[model samples]
Target: MPRPRTGRRVRTLLAAALTTLAPLVFLTGPAQAAPAAAGAWTPAPAPVVSHVETDDPVVFITIDDGWATEEAAGARQLLLERRIPASLFLLPDAYERDRDYYRTLLAHGPSRIENHTTTHPDLTTLTEAGQRAEICGARDRQLAAFGDGPRLLRPAGGATYNWPYHNADTRTAAPACGAEAIVMWTHDLTTWGSWTPPTPELKAGDIVLLHMGPTLEADLTRALEAADAAGLSPAPLRDYLLG
Candidate 1:
């Protein structure tokens, strides 16, 4: 039931065309993640955009996972009333399990959903095939369920990003899934409870992360209020990167 991705197909054809003309031109190796530095990639299919480097008056709020039965409703309500923008990195199965809950979130407006993974695994530990399965499989499910939902990839267990070693799939999975970027956060705000990191506050161009958890509602409320008091305007990740 997933909608076809015209862009993915186009990339496929373009690769073929370039392959046939190989004798006439030169090409660089595909962009990779291993030399995993701390920022965005220079080339297209750039897997990750950790933080934007502009003085724009925008901060980003991105919530991770879905079907968190305890706090999803409260989080959804807070997002709706505040009219603050947030980008949610969702697990496809989790969202599908509670379609009615997430459906209301979409209806509430001012939010966009992006990809987390199908089963939520550490991509650095998986083979390339496994990485693609996790990334593309989840995206396909999201498309099937929500009709073109989720266009960014956030590898599971991203908190350990500072760890010295990572496989190439960490970056390649983004393009493999036909995702725009491998989105990473500047701050993992633990105020609302945490699975990964504990960040202090929002700043201009900071990408904030929170999880769906017991304290999600209270944590998000405090964070949102603090962000407003500090005069930071929230925007979707896509808008900040593209626009």
Candidate 2:
């Protein structure tokens, strides 16, 4: 029989529910969006933060899920050299394991680390209390580590069939946990596997997604170079969304 999932394993198994969704709401919307002002705390119209409709010339490079390694260490330097501004949504486990590693990225420059969650769970199936624990727990850890920035929750989600994945409870729990928005992605570079989507060219205000891994060095190098070739300047998600 298939192994009965438990705890974190259940999370891994349940996440498969989101495998068939193609989230491109913002980019598909109007070409012009009045940029938001600073200190805006409103959530995007969707429960997840896939992309935002903005009439700006800049694109955002957002990296999620930390798997610290020498490759990532080197990538941080490349980030500095290239002056790539990125938003990192870090899981508490990854952060705890590589606190100093990510701190180096934060210490170096404009890269900001937000919360992904405490235990990398699929929030859709969780109860209110469970969602709160994940969101609030991650926010607390991020604050303790990265100090302060945007309280955005980049819930541990990917897959397609699911849009936001986090149910109504997730919405209620996020603000309580200090998250302003539940950030998702518009385009993802599946660095861990061989299924990378064809990223033709990054458009203005597009949110490009990446994950930390052994392939990050090559993947980031390639992605940033593409951004440059496409004339899309990478910007911080905080400014692009909340202004």
Highest lDDT against the true fold, candidate: 2
For model 1, name the residue pairs that clash: 47-182
lDDT (tens digit, per residue) of candidate 1 on 68-175:
655557777888887767888888877877887766777777787788888777677777568778888888888888787566677787445433122344445566
User: Scored by CA lDDT, what does every candidate get?
Assistant: 0.65, 0.66
lDDT of 2 by residue, 109-226 (tens): 7888877778777788787678888878877777777787446677765344354566545654676676666677767765657665565577776777888877777778777777
Off by over 4 Å in 1: 1-47, 158-166, 191-201
Q: Using TM-score, give the best candidate's number.
A: 2
- What TM-score does candidate 1 get on C-alpha atoms? 0.73
Error of 1 at 121 (Å): 1.0
Give per-residue lDDT, candidate 1, residue 202: 64
Candidate 1 worst ten-residue window by lDDT: 21-30
Off by over 4 Å in 2: 1-47, 158-164, 194-196
In model 2, the Cα lDDT at residue 239 comes to 69
